[model samples]
Target: MGFRKGISILTISAAFALALSGCTSDKPAPSASTAPTASSSPSDSGEGGTDAKLEALGLDSNLKFKETRKITVEVYDRGNDGGTKPEDNFYTTYIKEGMLRDHNVEVTFVPVPRWTETEVINNYLAANQAPDVSLTYSYPTIQTYANMGGILDLAPILAENKELFPDMFEYLTETNIYWDQDPATGTLWALEGRLNVLNRINTFVRQDWLQKLNIEPPTNLQEFESMLRAFKDNASTLLGADADKMIPFSTSFDVGWRADHLTTSFMPNDLTDKDIYVNGFDDRLFLMPNYKEGIRTLNKWYNEGLVWKDFPLYPAGDTTEDNLMKLGHVGAFMHNWDYPYRNGDDSIHASLQRLVGPDAAYVAVESFPNDAGVYKKFLSGPIDRKVFFPATNKEPIASLLYVNWISKFENRVFLQFGEEGVTHEKLPDGSLKTIATTGEKIMNSPANIDYTITSNGINLGDPDLTVKSIANGYAGVDSKLIEIAHKITTNDGRIGKNANVGQIKAEDGQGQALKEKRDTILNKAVVAAVDKFDEIYDSGMKDYLNSGGQAIIDERKAAWEKTYGTETMLK
Candidate 1:
């Protein structure tokens, strides 16, 4: 593609070079004009001249094309509970009307299945029918497409029009926007979306069960296991006639994900930045030092009837485990920071309260500890999803403008909260309280993240406000519990170190397949007999290393060494 006007040939080449280089800085490139601040929340009518107002803040006023330019943006079709069509809902209509009015752009949303986004996006890319703007959690997919010349290099466009995307740059900041710039060729295939929420997983136990049994919350690994054993040994007392249905600790087939808090706690405290970056491909840290012993602990629990035995039968989306939790049969689980409080009145905690009692609820606790006796959570970096454009995009600038529009606080707040009284309510405290809605006004995804493509988590204008507002999201749950859960989840959290030594080309086209193999290895090892756990785990790991895992490790190590030249860590 040719460079846009105002970006000279020298600028384009330099931008390209920066794109291919590793993410070496956390600052945004200098722009011609200062970025703009968001206006007060849009009026209820949503009738303001958005472009005129935005341009008044020093953004480029020349965004209006000579004629209406049509572009498609991808949205996740979660098939959420409310029965709203992801591509044709009230939010979509609002976006369409606003974009068309503001910039003379005809916007269309193409829905990709949330469960199979990577596979579907790849298919669309191969068919040359990918949306102009799209997103995915798989950076390697974008890298693979860029290597094949199927993706657009956005470095020049972003560099030249930094003034146009003032709000986008403001929220994403320099750190996330340029996080994936390659170190070698300087080609930016994608822009990393800002992950506003950094809360990771925490272990949750049945507080009511603990109270009924007169047991206090576990303080460490030994106490944690003792609690589970107590649950198993006293199932009849806890469940009455349904004692046989009790599951002391339950997890799913994706053991690595479900048991991450436990496994991560076992990771050594002294792993270098190079060690983290090189072996972080597994995402679960399954390959990290001492991870095997963590899984071994689970295996021992499994053989002793303290852990769920049917986890291997359930796949990624299976509801068996969730049903168990809702039925009040699961005594404990390690999952997302707010796992129990999600889904408002329909959440697992709510269901437990209805079926069991008002006091029955899952409460967050810190139990597992690393060898150093600390709960160390390996958190994701500030980046979340990767947003990019395909080569077939007819209006890259319009697409950028579209994202910029959504990144504005007014537009994002409205889209996220949806006409106040209908989908949410303005609390007396000046924070939004999300509410239940029906038909077209329902939010299919949390905070409408599927629609707000460039930003994730809550961004309610202030960091403290954003965090305080998070607890208010769970409609029926006590905000205090959510507040406590959030605190526990983020405590002792460490963002995994990444050298950003450009793309590990060996990782291209290998992520999904290797992930399946990873699940296989962990599943078999976690279910093996206690005496045979090491043998099974070692064999599975050997097979995994042979199947492209080693290639990734080798490439990552080589890339890190080449970038820093024997410096094990980047300061």
Candidate 2:
């Protein structure tokens, strides 16, 4: 669904870039005028004021629209594929057209080639041709851009335009740790889009095969191992010499998809060493005990042949694992809850039902208990996919009115789902359904309809609608998934709190060498401890903890005292 990162030179390069960007520079003091005021409508004049026409439109409250008489916006085109029809290409016909005709806004789509590097985009920006908005992968990237003054500090705009972007602003303030405020400057550099949670890393198994073998879905690690062995043995008996065709488990290790789940099962703690409680501080690298246990279990599983030996070499694009699962030869693997099969729309659940009747059931394993019997919880970051804007046209009142008009629920549904009678028709019941193309009733249609309209740069409609459409379906399929998703606590509770780190600025390349040296040693020691568990337990692991780990703890204590005026370390 998204790109993956590895422990490679690229990561090192990114760290170097962060260091060169002077992420540790102290934040400037907040301007006294930055405070919120009752008369702070964008129409008042100066950098923050807007015309009365725009003030009526609702643009005055949040955004300090530039004094430029005309607003021309630039955005990236992320959904273009070669052979895509204009209507079929949601970006072309819907989003751009809707914004121009309805909102009376001038916008340009800057289409970057798919799979282009970030450097290319950054270089374009450095040439004074950067789009008003751009996509980023992490908080570090946001910080880098903000440090270079390439991006806007969206906090004030977000605060003022709460009516238009209520859910989005709320989610950023309540859910995202990176967006936390800087205590010194009282400014937020960037807005967050979404968080990735553990629900997406579900485990899928061959329900049809389980029925044939009269095996129940495994609940715990012990039972899971037994089931795998049983499947292997049964396949050997059934297929004779071709028993290897019946793969008990298969997964691609290249992208770390399967590896993440296995690790999660063993070590359910939050993985990042960064202060899950603070934003801008040195990470507590390799401090979690469960990390070591997780790696050791993975090694054990690899040595025992429970996992496929060829996993390390598997190409991410190959569908060998999915093919085997479809053929009912694979017993288990890590996957999304719904796995695609040969039939385009058929999913893992549907395939099992077709192959072995309706008696088969699928189980989603969430966590495994340690010796203390506590179900260690593991969660990923929030989905940072979409963002909103405050209308900042010269006619500030007009912009606000436009935003308020669009914020209405009726307009939101239309913008998101399209004209009820054309793209979709309401069922006899209240629920909406896609219209039949050729009078043949279609149960489900592609959900990309809204993506086309919203992809247009100037449209600042509610993103919550999109989130609902994406998360609601799967959420209904399994409640536990959503429950676990909500429990995923960010490192910092919210963006305002974490923004404090931005106040501590640094010189170019000053933090680079130190960061590299720290990360290198940490990675080497952690990898060694995981790879040579027996030796590490006897020698390096204990010594490393007493030496390096304690030093990190001391550093954290000092940092905490400086930031919060407290000394709160155990040792």
Best candidate, lDDT-wise?
A: 1
Best TM-score among the predictions, by candidate number: 1
User: Residue by residue across 280-299, what tens digits does model 2's lDDT show?
Assistant: 23322233445445556655
User: Considering summed lDDT, which 10 consecutive residues are worst modelled in model 1?
Assistant: 35-44
TM, every model: 0.89, 0.60
524-566: candidate 1 lDDT, tens digit per residue: 9888888888898999889988988898899988988887897
